[model samples]
Target chain A: MGVDERRQQLIGVALELFSRRSPDEVSIDEIASAAGISRPLVYHYFPGKISLYEAALQRASDDLASRFVEPPEGPLGARLLRVMRRFFDFVDDHGPGFAALMRGGPAVGSSTTNALVDGVRQAAYLQMLSHLKIEDPPARLELVIRSWISLVESTALIWLDGRRIPRAELEVQLVHDFAALAAVSAAYDQEMAEVLRQGLKDEPGEGPFSDLVVRLVALASPPAV
Target chain B: MGVDERRQQLIGVALELFSRRSPDEVSIDEIASAAGISRPLVYHYFPGKISLYEAALQRASDDLASRFVEPPEGPLGARLLRVMRRFFDFVDDHGPGFAALMRGGPAVGSSTTNALVDGVRQAAYLQMLSHLKIEDPPARLELVIRSWISLVESTALIWLDGRRIPRAELEVQLVHDFAALAAVSAAYDQEMAEVLRQGLKDEPGEGPFSDLVVRLVALASPPAV
Candidate 1:
């Protein structure tokens, strides 16, 4: 393999190892053996274990960030649901790795790892804004968006614990969560209200947001006798 | 000072120092000077910097957990607002320390520190259930409560950055966020819906939940041409 191909292959092997166990627990010799290369060759591509680990993380980060990328098509709720599904797919595929990276494993204070994590968040935020098609979101809109992002993150992290809630339900619920968060903000700010109005304009009756409204109305009605 | 009192004083000094700077940056000498004691005395009370940091974190964790404690009286929104106020107060008082602890500082993988943080979350969760008067929460309701708690945590962490938005608004918004989270779940789960119904029974027109409902209604109205 070419140098670039060889480097990518090493990162792939390292990420697979890191996914099953924390980065610190994985050894250099193990990576070399797994990659079907010598330990010195592993060092030839990267300076040290930390460097190799970071390369793996960078690739993982890029893969995770790409999960948030959805075309600005269809209803906003449907779009968000798709994004949530993909996000969880990544979490599901890379459970331990995702948790370790999120929980700050041994690479805890490493600025590079931290930046990669934050980059994913920033990318997700910007992607959401693009979905909203809002050039300059109001402060309240930003808060709502950022808060929803954090909710999605914590939800995924917790979901990984026992796989307690069905992944499908959480995906739909998360989309509803976005609407719920924005609706609350819309109530307070006209800009947000306008944003919500635009967002719901194209939503169908079967969309997550519509389902949420139906559920809420059912809840508001007097209990069955 | 007596041994226990001296230990308390040292923890206080260390927490104060850690609040301003990362625990790793705050040396034993600084802690000793801050406590008006010698390095040996600091060591005498605690074996090492890590132990002392854990003690300080334990204290902070307890303090944080206590902020979630509120009487199970009056409107739930009012109770939650009070809780949010106290929570932000703690965040304001210990900005860097809270961020470091949450973001995973040098003490990242320390099981003791991780337990303390999780303990605080569990305590807050139980406190919320007590406030709701729910002995057994359905899985959906559990998700709502846990998700809200995570929302509150991330909100505070983000707010601490520049505190760009007014603190007072965020506090009130958080209470609304809780109602919104529960309201969304209530739409789907009868158990959660009943919980919301009970929560809203005594809420006044001026309460956060009521305010959220009013805002949502206003947004739902046909926009003026």
Candidate 2:
């Protein structure tokens, strides 16, 4: 097999082992044995155990990122919903692998992994923010995005664990939930902006508090609404 | 120190170490040294590294569970809001430790940690069910609880990470977001019930599709107004 093919095969085997056991439990020997190759062959492709685990994690993270990175053109809400649906579907199908990644995959400690996951999360959030027509400051946008992703990951895991509701139904429920959360976030942002504007005038140099108020005010003002 | 005091001390030290580094990287010897005890003494308190890690995790989990296991006292929505606020507060204060546990603390596999996390999640859901004046089947209630927990956990983590919103303001946002999620879930559940009622007249078999429809219908029904 070519280098790329061999590398891919190693990752597939690593994933299989990761799925069957904890990341820390799986040994390099086990991965090699499972892949029907010698330990040296496995080492040839990856530098170490951490690298192998990260490679497997990156593969799953990349798959998920690719699914929603450039969402197809459509209504913002609909497009966001599609991305969520795809995410939930991926989680359901690749239960163990996806769970490992979201639950802080070994790659989590690696800046590369953080960037990959954060990039995907930011893209989805941007889509939602654009749809809402709210131009929040970067920090506020970060809060909204992080909050939304946490909700998605938590909800998806619950559904994946077979909580009596089927995946399809849960997906619909999540879309609605996401919409509601977005609306609440928008309204709260607006309310905070008003409060900040009123409170800041009385205290000009409140340091971080003033900075926070400014961000809220900027976020609260809707775009051309 | 008394048994309880020593135990708590161990948990604290374990959390500190776990948060700073991966479980595998930290040894019992390190935990012992950090706690100002010998390795053998550490072993006396807990069987091994894994046991110590699990105990630490259980401590954190127990702390959160104690506040939430039983539904808070008040009106349904008010009680839920209170519990959720406390939940967020807990996450905000104990984020690093909570993150460590959720990300699989030493000795605990992701699946095992996930199951523990899900247990706390389910408990919160039960609390919500008890507080809400819903008259749905237990199964349907389960779905709502699951969805609500998912929403709260996701949103809370964002706030926990020191987002632009002040912690106090983030708590208020969560209250609004959760109230909105509960409202939507109730409405969606009601709509599903209506669909089920309409479809039951046309289909009478107990096949997979019929079972799925029945389950969805039950899950979708809203709490009694």
lDDT of 2 by residue, A20-78 (tens): 55576789999999889999988899998888887787777667766665443444445
lDDT by residue for model 2 (B1-225), tens:
998799789889987776565566778889999999999888888888877877776766777776665443433334444566677667766666565455343344545466667677666665555554344644544555565566566556565556556766555566556544444444446543432233223333643224432432332243266
Model 1 chain A: weakest 10-residue lDDT segment is A102-111
Candidate 1, B133-182: lDDT as tens digits:
98887777778888888899888888887787889988988888888888
Best by DockQ: 1
Clash count per candidate: 1, 6
lDDT of 1 by residue, A58-100 (tens): 9989999998899899888888888999998888888887877
Q: Please give the CA lDDT of all the candidate structures.
A: 0.85, 0.60
Against the true structure, whose lDDT is highest? 1
Clashing pairs in 2: A150-B154, A151-B154, B189-B220, B189-B221, B189-B222, B190-B222
